[model samples]
Every structure is written in structure tokens, then in C-alpha cells.
Target chain A: MPIIVNLDVMMAKRKISSNELADIVGITAANLSVLKTGKAKAIRFSTLDKICEALDCQPGDILEWQNPAEKT
Target chain B: MWNKHRSLKLSRILVLCFSVMIFMMTFFVPFVADWYEDVSDGMGLIGGSVYVPMMVTLYVCEGLAVWAVAELHILLKNISKGEVFIERNTRCLRCISWACLLAGGVFGVMALWRFLLFLPAFFAVMFGLIMRVLKNVFEQAVEIKSENDFTI
Candidate 1:
């Protein structure tokens, strides 16, 4: 996890709830939660495509990479 | 028709039957030994002189057999429940493999007194090796499965 998911931040900026985003993204709320909480190991391109279309944002807006050593 | 579920059920029943047979054999060890001696024409390897040591070896092997059988039962139970690649099944396989190896070792020692005992000792060791391989396979499968599950 140095690669972080900023899904919640993007969702908040877009004024979209998890349930609503999940509905538009054609995924379950549980999966959306997993993506939002950064627990997902990897994201499918198709899922990312749907999420970006739903949130009107790029993949880069929802994903970030930070150095673990720098965090400490 | 043969099927996976029925096959598993049969394997479970066979394990249960083997356990019961082993339990019953515990009570009949002395008589069975006597009968074996008689059938073998009082072979110097199994008769009165070597009876005590023979009984000791047999009991040790019986203990290992029981341990192996119990582990097998649990392994089968887990497989029946669709939990094949879990950690518990790998532990069960490891235990069963060790039990087989220990029983083989016991038999190998007894084989010093009787050459014929070496056959079972060889088979047991081979069986143990197969189980050990299977345990390794399961460990890898469980790791892969965990990675796959978390990939979403």
C-alpha cells in the first residue's frame, strides 16, 4: 500500500454517496467500500473506467502513491 | 453414478470404519498376536520370545494409525464443506504425514526382527511422502487463493 485510493475524497468532491456511486459504477456497495477504504489489492481497468465515468474524474484523481518511509 | 460428493462421503465412511476397526483391534491384540504366531508356525520372530517387543511395536503403530485416521477424518470433513485449500486442511495433512512417517519408523525398527515387516514400512514411508507433497501443494494453493480473494 504505498499506492493509496483517494476514492472517498473524490466522491466527497463530486457530492456522491457510496451507494449512489456503486449504483452508477455497476458494483456492489461492499466493493465500493473496499475501493474507498484502500483495501483492494488491485482495480480492474473496466471498473476504473466505470468509476471515472460515474464520478466525472480521472483515475489519477482517485489514486495516489506516497513513499512509506516519508510518511513516518 | 460416481461423483465428487458421493466419493467424499464414501471416503469419510471408510475412514470411520477404519477407526472402528482399529478400536476393536486394540482389545484383540494379544489374541491376534497368538493367532499370528500359530499361523506362522511359531516363527521365532513373532512367538513367545519376541512377543513383548512385538506388542510394543504394534501398539505404537496403532497409536500413529489412530492419529493419522483422525486427521484424515477432519481433512475429509473440510473438503466436504468446500474448504479444501484452507490452512486447517494443510495442518491435517502435515499431521497425517508425520503420523505415517512415525509409524513407518516404528515398523522399520520391528523389521530388524522380521524381514517381512519391511514391506509395510516401505509403503508407509511412501504414503507419508505423498501426503507431504500434497500438504505443500495445499499450502501454495491457500496462498494463491488468499491473494486472489484480496485482489478485488
Candidate 2:
């Protein structure tokens, strides 16, 4: 839970819908939803590569780490 | 191919027949003797030849179902972790496995009941133990699904 996916935030900043990203990344909308919601345990390198390429951003921009106890 | 489907269909029919035999045992075996108080008059007549063949066939069919379910679980786990991608999955297969487990348990209990009736209580406990194993596996399937949204 400490490793958070900031995909939705990044998607909003870049003005991309989850569906559209799913299309660009060649994955299903549901999977994209998982990543967006931070429910995914891990992301495949191939998918991560595609996502970064599609969004024109680095992986660091999409993934943020926070200690659970430090949550606001 | 149609031929492949035909062979699969035949095997399915055979499995169904075996299931029917088990069903017969569950229903009729009870009337023949109470599940427990009949306990040890050497009950539940599954005769040697019929018993061996039924056990073999059930073993094979159930083995296939178990293997498929296990593979499906693994695929689901991978999908959850994003290590795999799927176009679709076997919802039918999962449903069939659950049905098989329940049905198999019931028939086994009915057939064995006369031993405890001739032998019922301890037999039920044995069946309970088997049920627990099947339940755990089913739960693993469920965990894989919940983690994978059952079908995402």
C-alpha cells in the first residue's frame, strides 16, 4: 500500500482518459482502471514502457512512494 | 475442429454418466441404510469392478478440472500483477469445477454413509476433510479473482 500509482493524476495533467490510455497502451480499460486506482500489485515492464511512451512522461511521474504511517 | 469437439463431447458424456452413478449412490444408498446407525454391516455396495472403473474415471475427469482451475488461478494472479494479459478466460470451466466438487462430495458422502450408518459419522468427518481441501482451493481461485476482479 505504500507504493502508490499516481496514474489518474498524471492522466488528468496530460488530459488523457483512462480508456484512451488503455487503447494507446494496448491494454483493457479494466486493467487501466486497476492501475489508476492503485489496486494493481505490479505493472509489467512492457505495459509500463508503453504507458510511459503514450503519456510522454517518466515512470517516476506516475509512481509515488509514501509510508503508510505518514499519510495525511 | 468438429472432430476435437466430438471427442471432448464424448469425454464429457462419460463424466456425466459417472456423475449420475454418484448421484444414484447419494440418493438410493441412504434408503438402503441410514447414513450412520447402519454403521458397519459392511454397507454401500459399490462392488469391486464397478468401484475400480468409477474411481479411475472420476480421477481422470476431476484431475482435468483441477488442472484447469489451477492454471486459471495462476493466469488470474498474473493478470492481477500485470504480468500477463488476457483476451478472455474460462468462466464455464470455473463454474464446472465448483459443480464437480460439490457433486463429488455429496456422492462420496452418500456412498460412504452406510458404513457409518453402517458407518456414517466418521465417514462424514472424512468427507468434511475432503470438502475443506476443495474449499481451500476454491478460495485460492476466489482470491485470484478478487485480485483480478474475477474477470478483468
Question: For residues A1-51, what per-residue lDDT tens digits would candidate 2 score against the true structure?
Answer: 798888888889999988899999998998888778777876788988998
lDDT of 2 at B112: 48
lDDT of 2 at B137: 66
In model 2 chain A, the worst 10-residue window by lDDT is: A34-43
Give stretches of model 2 more than 4 Å off. Answer: B1-118, B148-152
Clashes of 2: 17
Model 2 lDDT per residue over B76-129, tens place: 455445543232333433444454555455445445423333233344345445
> Taking chain A by itself, what TM-score does each prediction score?
0.95, 0.91
| Weakest 10 consecutive residues of candidate 1 chain A by summed lDDT | A34-43
- Model 1, residue B56: what's the lDDT? 83
Error of 2 at A27 (Å): 1.6
